[model samples]
Structure formats: structure tokens, C-alpha cells
Target: MKQQKGFTLIELAIVLAIIGIILGAILKGQELINNAKAKRLLNDVKGWATLEYTFYDRYGRFAGDGDGDGLIDAGAFATSQANFGANYIPPTSALLTPTTAYQNSDFDAPVATLEAAQLLPAAQNAPQRRTNVTNAFNGITYPASVYIDNVGTFNVIAVKNIPCFAAKVIDSNIDGSIGANVGYVREIDNTGALTGNNTWSCDANNNEQQLVSLVYFFDKRPN
Candidate 1:
């Protein structure tokens, strides 16, 4: 009978080391992938923000009317183009002229008229409503005085405006501790997805929403 052959201890050790290296490489690759995904998501959010601003500029409000009305009518003032434009310009009669309130196709001209003003109060005073554009995600739910904190590692996620008497995010918190009320939650992936336990703070004193971090992924290496 032929003598049985077996791997020497050194050969076995080498094989185990190779396996460990392969596992490490795979983990590193996954980390890189996740990092890239996070960055992409961040970029996507920024792009969305741009679109939102543009929407307000072109149409006089945010993307959609929460009330599902054809026009950005009453109770839907936060995104009104007329209101935001009013806030942008100085008190010049041409810009501030009551007749200038209406520009977007969705709204009728001479929006300054009492009747027009009555149509969309929120849209008219959007600027005075809230400074930061409130995220009106279709199904995202959050508590009051919360906001998405984009600082430190992307470990913490999302934020919200403090619950206020009015339906606005800025006036939501009066104490200015809106930064401390940040919460952390897992990312949402499904329809009507909800993120819980996420940090809700101002972005590094920038007074802007970051929603992401710089070192997206750490210690990544080639597989």
C-alpha cells in the first residue's frame, strides 16, 4: 500500500494564513463598497436638495404639496415660490411690490392680492416659515425639534425639527439646543421606511444640514 501523504505543520500554517489574508481582503473590499455607497447616497441627497431649491425657485415652493392639491394652495406655504422670492429680494417696490408675489406658472399673477395671499399663506411666507428646507419625505417619520446630523463618523443618521406649535421646522426649537436633540437610527431601505435612533443635530455649527461624513469608509484595501 502506498504511504499516506499529509500536509506538514508549516504547510498547514501557510494555508491558514492565506485563508485569513483572503478573508481580510474580502472584508476590506466590502468596507470600500459600503463607503462608496454612502458617498453616493450623500451626493444623491445633495442633488435632491438642489432640485428642491430649484423647485422653489421655478415653481415658488418645494417639490410637492403635502395636501395633494393641484396648486400649492393654503397650508402649503413652506415651498411657495412667491413667498421665497419675496424673502430673497430687498424692499424694492419692483421686487417687493405686492404684485410681484406671483411668478411661477402654478400660481396666478398679482399674488399679493388679498385673495391670492389667502390662497397659500404657507407658500407666501415660506422664507419666514423655516430657514432650512424641511425634508418632506413621503413616509419618513421623526420626532419634534430633530434634524439629521452629518458630523463625525456616519454612524449617526438623520435629524428633525423640534415639535413646535406651528407646522414649521425652524421655529420648532426656541432654546437653540436643537443640536443636542440629535438622534441616531439605522438607514431606511424599504417603502415608507423609517429610521430610528439616529442623531438629529446641526451640522458642525455650519447651520446647514450635512447628512453625511467625510471618512465614509475606513481602512479599505484592494482585494
Candidate 2:
């Protein structure tokens, strides 16, 4: 058999350099994507809060607070109306009172509630639990949600289903620091607790990659 000559140092170095460049580009691309997701998640929370507040500004009430209890709630506190009447008032619509029923047919009434009040254009009812923006990971599309939640002692509109990494970035960006239970933007575990409590999903663990919720206070803080 004829002996084969080994590759020159320059050729080997060129191959290694190309590999480094490809790896660097991939890492940079992933970082950029993560940043983009964080930004979109931030915008999602702000947009939902704005929509609810805009409804408040226009109708003096939240989109899903059928009882006008100053909260956007579901289940026992969710709107009980299959369809609102023409005379429905957003702020004080006693016609649609709260009742107990998990996953009521009208569970996703926030969007419809807004449309019924002429805030949003009347269209096909949105799928259950969809907010202003959706985040997709592992090929599963996650629609972030807005509802009444608390941070410490203050109630706020919580935006849910944000990736932990993205939530951290968002919290830092909003509050100028990262934290679990303090600041304008705070983290909430899947259990709806003010503190993450080192839960696998919102805190440290294998499930840390799981999604969590973030609450934006709109600068509403207790004195």
C-alpha cells in the first residue's frame, strides 16, 4: 500500500478555524434568539396589561372581571355569561355574575369581553387562554396568559408561561436586577406563590427549564 502524506499544519489550522467560526456563529445566533424571546415576552406582558388598562380607561373595568371586584379572575370568579347582552356594562355588568365552574365554556372571555364592549373588533372568539403574544419552544406553541395574581401583598396582572431564562432577563431589564419576589417585575411559581421557593420550575433544578409567570405592577406598590 502506498503511504499517504499527513495534512499540513496550515490545512489543519484552517479546518479548526472554520469549526470555531461555525460554533461561535451558532452560539451567537442562539443568544440572539434568546434575547429576542425575552423581548417578545416583555412586550407580551406589557401589551396585555395595556389592553386590560385600556379597557379600564375606556370602560372603567378589567376585561374579565365580570363581578367588578377589581380582579381578572377565572374559575369561580370568571364570567358566567355565554354571551353578553347589548346593554352590558363593562364596569358593573351584574347580568354576568360569577359562578363556580372550572373551565367554563366562556373561560376565555377576556377577549370577548373586550370585543363585546366595542374595545376590540368583534371577530371569531379566540381559543381558550390566548394572550397578546405566544412563545413556542420544542415545537409546542405556548400562549401566555393574563390574570389577577399577586406579588407579595400587591395584586397584579400576571403574564404566564414565560421560559425561566427569558423571565430572568425580563425581570432584570424591568427592575434593573433579578429577584423572585421583590420589584416591579417579580416571579411566580406554577403553584401561584409570590415566591419561587426554589421550586423545580421557577427556581433551581432540572425542571428549571420549565416555564414560569411574571407579574408587572405598572408601578403599583404599597407604601
Top candidate by TM-score = 2
For model 1, how does the per-residue alpha-carbon lDDT over 60-170 read when each residue is reduced to its tens digit? 543322232222221211123233233332222332222233333222222222212232233334353233233332111111111123421111112222111111122
Tens-place lDDT digits, model 2, residues 71-133: 554322122122222222232233234441213233345555655665555544332223222
Estimate the Cα RMSD of every predicted model relative to the unseen true structure.
16.9, 6.9
Evaluated with lDDT, which candidate comes out highest?
Answer: 2
What's each prediction's clash count? 29, 0
* Cα lDDT over the full model 1: 0.30
Lowest summed lDDT across 10 adjacent residues in model 1 is found at 214-223
